[model samples]
Target: MATVSEVGELLIQKQQTITSAESLTAGLFASTLAEVSGISAALKGAFVTYSPEMKEALIGVPHILIQRHGVVSAQVAEAMARGAKYQTKADWAVSFTGVAGPDELEGQPAGTVFIAIIDDHDEVHIAQGHFAGNRQVVRQQSVQQALDELTNLLSKN
Candidate 1:
């Protein structure tokens, strides 16, 4: 995984800001970014929507989306990224939604994760992954993946 400082430096150089809407990983993605010195300049904010209601109310993840795709789908992840960008007015946004558990959720097995990144132009990129681990490991891996995905996308931009 790239160091948080490296991600921070890249964002700073690009004059771009990022926010996260996290579920299974909670706020780990945001916390990781904030750990880097000078990240505040390009780290806009974060929303830890660990529940369906919070996702709906805070990030505008429509009830229909969650109902249609469940909380752990790529659609929810994309909605979250776009919603975070709109809510925080950041140049970039990333979102993670998944079943990180000792058990399955919405009929999906544990480690079923989806991540999405939305850029300033509203272009979105999403990835779906299945990991192998315990709950904590799954969550940690999700966070790392979210950061890595953002780093890759920003680098390409």
Candidate 2:
């Protein structure tokens, strides 16, 4: 898997940009990107749509879509990435949505996460993961996986 720094380096080399929409991992995805030196040139912005409403209001996710697939599902993850892409006009956007908790959410078990990537072309790719750990560990894993996905996607381009 590619590290966040590796992703940042590639973005810089390509002269592209990125944005993030986060839920389960909060700002970890964006924060991690920020940790990479010289990333400011590539990271357009990021949003933390922790609330279901914000996913719609701030990120432009459709209410009916979330209602149908639940907030933690891949559908919502894709929508979140698309929204971030639309808002930031970045060359790439990543999104995270999941249940990272001591309790279930919308009947889904904890550690259930969906990660999505929307490339400049607006094509969407999604991945689902079920981690086993406490809330912090689940979130950490989500952030790492999200970055790795972005790295792989960038490598492809």
Candidate 3:
């Protein structure tokens, strides 16, 4: 099975909840987690903020961070994850932001995705993935990577 389902099973077993803040992948990351059976036991909520203003206003990403690192950078993804964790009161939170298209954003290449996760211990992790595909493929790969990372982190704990 895909890692999202595995992550769901682990989260259920551990009784941990997760929330999500999405940008480039939109809600694909959250939707993948929700696709797993019995995910409600651990799934908290999912927020789709595609715009920088929305990322800042909805997820509480700092304006200064966005100004410095741009919305597609790892810093914004980290802040978004942290903000989602606090906003949803979930044990863990994740954020996905980047350029997944035929065009570039803030000078970053397309298919560049930054996935960030905040564990229950308040530890944050970020990963940057470069994919070669259309918009759909990039989004799908990003979701898979995020789920895989979540599974790996859970294994360590």
Candidate 4:
């Protein structure tokens, strides 16, 4: 898988910026990008919306969507990606929302995750994942998966 630094380099080469809206992984997605040197030139910003209210207020994810689909659904993930793109005004954006738990959420089992990516053209791609581990491990795996997915998508673009 491509590293976050490699993704940053590609974005810089394309003269584009990227942003992230995170939930279960917190700011891990953004944190990984920020770790790359000179990423500020291509990484516009990131929003760590760990709560439903912040997701709605900060990233413009609709409360209704969250209510209907719950926080860890594909719909919420897609909305978050689009919302992050708008909020950051970046050429690309990614969002992650999921249940990384030792328990279930909204009838979904633990380790259920949804990762979404939105490009400049408004095209959105989503991937569903189920990881095995404790809460921390699930969250860490989610971040790695999200970064890998974003790297792959950016590479394609």
Pitting candidate 1 against candidate 4, the one with the higher lDDT is: 1
Clashing pairs for model 1 are none
Overall lDDT per candidate, in order of appearance: 0.89, 0.91, 0.91, 0.87
**TM-score of model 3 (CA atoms):** 0.97
Candidate with top lDDT is 2
TM-score of 1: 0.96
Model 3 alpha-carbon drift over 4 Å, by segment = none
Model 2 residue runs over 4 Å out of place are none
Quote the lDDT for 46 in model 4. Answer: 90
Worst 10 residues of 1 by lDDT: 145-154
Q: lDDT order of candidates, best first?
A: 2, 3, 1, 4
lDDT of 2: 0.91
Per-residue lDDT value at 84 in model 1: 93
lDDT by residue (tens digit), candidate 2, 44-102: 99999999999999999999998898998989999999999999889999999999988
Clashing pairs in 3: none
TM-score of each: 0.96, 0.97, 0.97, 0.94
User: Which tens-of-lDDT digit does each residue in 1-157 have in candidate 4?
Assistant: 5677778788888889998999988888788778888888988889999999999999899999999999989999999999989987999988889988888989989999999988878888898999999988888788778778777777777
